[model samples]
Target: MPRPLRSENLQGTLDLLVLKTLAARGALHGYAISTHIQQVSDDFLRVEEGSLYPALHRIEGLGWISSEWSTSSTNRRVKLYSLTAAGRRQLEIEQKRWDELTLAVKKVLECYG
Candidate 1:
């Protein structure tokens, strides 16, 4: 079984991934967003609805995303979310920060080992 997703484990990264997904994949419902992330990561990352819904609400509150009620392919009603201009900008900034942090970690690992 996959490990449960902890909010602390997500932290800053959730917003980044959420924003990037909206930017890249266009509008998606909460469940679709979670599934996209998990699929893209080859199932390495599993985002629970409990964690995802809060992040979606938080980012939407920030005006980073906008949503509207829409019918899914299955004819079920869902709130689809899309990235705003502000969200696109935020994604760029977050990607840069992530790159920097990973590069720093890579350097530390290389030097110490």
Candidate 2:
């Protein structure tokens, strides 16, 4: 059986995942973002609420994302997050960095094996 993923490793990739999620969906509330990540990962990834809010706030402060209190489709009030123009640009840069990191790690693992 495969070992479960650690939160420490997930922490390093949370921002990228969040950016991808917002980019793909356009806009999403905090709860939806967490739920989507968990669902899409088939429950392999567990996004803790504690870590998620801080990351959201950090990205918003960086101007990579914007948020507003809006009503969801179910009519409940929530802070819906969306990527700004700057955010999209940043996402492109980050995605490239992530791809590079992934490739480098893969190469290292291949060499070790």
**Against the true structure, whose TM-score is highest?**
1
Collision pairs in model 2: none
Estimate, for each residue in 55-87, the C-alpha lDDT of model 1 and write its tens digit.
899999999999999998899999999999999
How do the predictions measure up, each by TM-score? 0.91, 0.89
Q: Which residue pairs come into collision in candidate 1?
A: none
Residue 75 displacement in candidate 2 (angstroms):
3.6
Per-residue lDDT of candidate 2, residues 1-113 (tens digit): 45545445586688888899999998999888988888898777778778889999999999999999998778989999999999899889889999999999999999989
| Residue 55, model 2: Cα distance from true site in angstroms | 0.5
Model 1 TM-score (2 dp): 0.91
* Model 1 Cα shift for residue 104 (angstroms): 0.9
Model 2: number of backbone collisions = 0
